[model samples]
Target: MNAGNTFEVEVRGIRREAETVRSFELWPLGAESAESAESGEAYELPPFEPGAHLDVHVPGDLVRQYSLTNPHERHRYVIGVNRDPASRGGSIRMHDAVTVGSRLTVSAPRNHFPLNEAAVHSVLVAGGIGITPLLAMVRRLCELGRSWDLYYCARTESRAAFLRELRELADTCPDGALHCVFDGVPGTAPLDIRAVLAKHGAQADFYCCGPTPLMDAFTAALADVPPERVHLEYFKAPEISTPANSQAFTVTLARQQKSFVIEPDRSILHVLQEHGVAVMCSCREGVCGTCETAVLAGEPDHRDRVLSPEERAANRTMMICVSRCKGDALTLDI
Candidate 1:
């Protein structure tokens, strides 16, 4: 991450939202200083829309993207982190080493999963930690007096983060409703996404963020829905098999007037980094939009989950971390 493009924040408070989930409240440096306390006023941070995320630079030299959970109008940014046993160090560090008053670097907000503010009604589906982004959407929708329904799925109620807050919000809004489904409970059945969609009707815009299985089910259920009416974001890249016939390709950096050869086994990102190229990158697995580079020429074999189908068809930009040139050579804006 670029130091000039990031902000320094202090952890103001932390709460255990669930057994494995911890929510951190962050305030900009000096926001909670004696001056603000004496003045009894709040200090504002950079504005962001709902569904935005921050590239938090954590210990172990790892950068992980976590969605903002609070309303966009807030003075502080809130993020919930879930301790994953299979984590590659980010979440574990957040849960174990981080604490109140710890200073952290975070990039300004970026939103690939923006809520459609114009939609008359919205349906939000969340699985486990996926609720982070959707919670912000619900808060924004409520503020706008828009109708929305949320379907929250978790292994059990005890494992659901922000469950009490969601329920409280639902009770405050007559136009909004909340549904919970715990599949791990003995008597409970898994959420029937198809049935849920059917009951909600086709006019409501749908949004989902969850594990691979839930994401797959939600996507399949919305196969007939219009692209603009469906929204989703992935916390990690799906397990996709790379094409067996990938061939060597040459990439030309238009601005730098430099060229490099990319092997079939190596990623474009790795090749660029090896050549001393500076690119802002986080999740190299193609889940984060950090390594997205403008495509000046040639068709790209898109592999990232961040871009929509329409965007992929346009071939205007490609995530260099996992995507590559379709032909023998390609040009990039660098």
Candidate 2:
């Protein structure tokens, strides 16, 4: 809150969370100075909900999104990143290039996957690096006195993140429980995803974030469940769509009272920002919601993974970063 959307943050500490994952403790410079003014310690971070994430700009001009792991803290942020061999230089940079004194630029917290306060029972399922968001959700559930259950799946104990915190939650939870299911551990039973999805009651909501295979399997297994009862978080864009099938279109910025042609090669976000439009955007691939603009008029081509099927059909808003115009001319509230 003390800095702009993108601000400089120093890596205060670093600890190896797993064989491949490392946790980074970042402190906002201004916030740290303000906190040290009185008690000499910055705590927590600007208020963020359970499933919030920050867009971190790493070396080599690569930007990656990582979820916040601590829901109880407000002044500082803790993010766990796994050294991905296939990374486009982001995860590898975090693991190998960054150190305690390294400084990085990060976007403010934003939540695409949020918690449902009305649910009496919450079923939190996480896999591998996907445990970041769900870890915060568990802390939030404990703080709110809500009943919940966690199905944490990992290949082995050495590859899992937040083991200590999970153990503490398992011991302290009143009505909920923790189920640690590992596949690499000898003589340990594998996690049954179908059984976990089937056991939850009607009032219980299912939330999961993990590898694509795990998420796809969960989607297929929970197909019979009500659509409203199931939720998911995706770091990767599901699919990219364009207006190529249709003719060229025009975009009218309602507030600016300006119009521009949307060509085949150029995207709406590109054209808008080029025209000096002050629209905030991150994850140019359209996974993050920084460039979500209101749809006051005309239909839009919904291609981003952030919006649900119902939201896309409603034509209320769209993520302009990757989405396009479907009609000849589209009007926006921008």
Candidate 3:
């Protein structure tokens, strides 16, 4: 991630994908100022790798991470959001209230689950709204004339977004490279992993992003293949085994010069936000890096999905959403 390259962007457009999913396009608000200064008109932002995602700050709500669905060379940043009924009201508000002109603060793109370099072929499996990241990969691979196959599975055709474009691309591609499997598709079974693996063998690199059960099924089905060759992007954090009735703890904000006690059942993020402190965050499950804060003092029980062991050891940052303090109190840079 480029430290000085961050930009605050505004929503330029919004498009609905499904009843629960929407796509938003963002552009830098300072583009005109930069261009007027003859600093060279900012071209479309640099291209992100296949699995890159951006952390978007939704203001009153915590920051949230969304997969980039737009092509790399596009002049704007595009992200697809699904209105998760179980969400802590973030997705619901984003889907219902956010408009075309809304200003959303965003972090630069980051890639933790990049594409495999060794494999000559690629197999992308996307379930439901999980198609967002894979769609970007498909666009890039197509532009490069690379060999890849996309298997998109959904409950029905109505719930599937970008079906028309995907089908059109597959038709023009030499072979039938794109396959859509719907549960309602009469004679066809939905995403036959066993058959797919048996036919494709272990030669191609496999990428999957979707619900936990779908990912788990793929992981089990591809047990014969090398684990390193299989990549999975999870939208949520894996269930943790914290003490059933974990005790509450106090977190001190060094910059704000304040401290708050988190309830046994609540997270540190809730406590800080209740005190009117604006902490960066997204994906309360700890999967995304949006809520990461600088740990100025104290040991952190890191529970985020993005940070590596080395990152955790650095002790410079911590995701407060799901992560906890190891001791009585943790001091944050705020």
Candidate 4:
């Protein structure tokens, strides 16, 4: 609940989409009535593109980001949540405490995984709850009459969240395709990432969001593909290791006219917070792009999963939470 900007929404509906997954429909506080939505009345919620997510402020001061699954043109936002065995207070609270008509604060929609609408073709690969964001992309692509393919993977058929909706969508699109892979079923092997990429050829832009192992395999299989054509979103940050010979660096805040020494053991975020510098951050592991800062002058040793490889090479910005300066001195537009 510590975000800089947020608005209130009331839960209008909650439906169990799968065995362990539930879809929540949220509408702005004043326009929460079902009649308004049905009547085609104007509801003034902020517009969002596909692959956008909202930071939902749940009870107990916990904030979690969930991708929007509904069509981008809709007035309300829909998000799917899976009950994880490893409860982190957010998912458990959403399942046990939140009910219809509940009021919650959520950040405005922000997108880190954007669809390349101009690409010749789009290929979407999703696993489990990762289907949330890609579903929006599929809806948008259908609206635009674009060619696309979706490969939805899950542990079992019962675990797939929006299978029926996806099938209906595929049936309507003459050029779109949908493939479901349930690898955990008996006698079924995991989807071969290499074989899938080989079929798409050179014109397709690939998008993937899934568990760590699935994403890792997809990334490795597409190693030769141009960075611009490969888009990925991570649910959690991967393990990051610092170099053994890492050295301390100095950061100069341009606006504040201040300089601080960033120790090798401590992150730049921690040092800035200790000095009373206000920087909003969440998911300190670098999966969320909350602490992204402009780099006036410095080559950042990018360790964040949020940024693409092309962006890292540009060195125009850096995530303060886990990334560090490549050299001894750096300049930032604090």
Give me the displacement of residue 80 in model 4, in angstroms. Answer: 1.0
Which lDDT value does model 1 have at 74?
40
Which candidate ranks first by lDDT, i.e. highest? 1
Residue-level lDDT tens digits of model 4 in 144-253 = 99999999999999999999999998999987999999998998888888998999957899999999999999999999998889999999986657888678999999
Error of 3 at 255 (Å): 13
Per candidate, the number of residue pairs that clash is 0, 7, 3, 0
| Candidate 2 lDDT by residue in tens digits, 198-253 | 68856789998988777877888888888778888876765535444855689998
Record all residue pairs in model 3 with backbone atoms less than 3 Å apart, i.e. clashing: 63-281, 63-282, 281-291
lDDT tens digits, residue span 1-334, model 3? 2333556677878888875678888876654432442344454455677788987777575667788876554357888888888977777778877897788767788786677644678898999989999988878777777788999988888888877778887777663398888876677676888788887765888888988778878878998888667777887876657766466778888878888887767898888788777766657777777677889888887777667567788878888888887778888887
Error of 2 at 60 (Å): 2.8
| Model 2 local distance difference test score | 0.82
Q: Candidate 4 — which pairs collide?
A: none
Which of the predicted structures, 1 or 4, would earn the higher lDDT when compared with the native? 1
Q: Residue 104 in model 2: shift from native, Å?
A: 2.0
Rank by lDDT, highest first. 1, 4, 2, 3
RMSD of 4: 2.6
Q: Point out the worst 10-residue segment of candidate 2 by lDDT.
A: 37-46
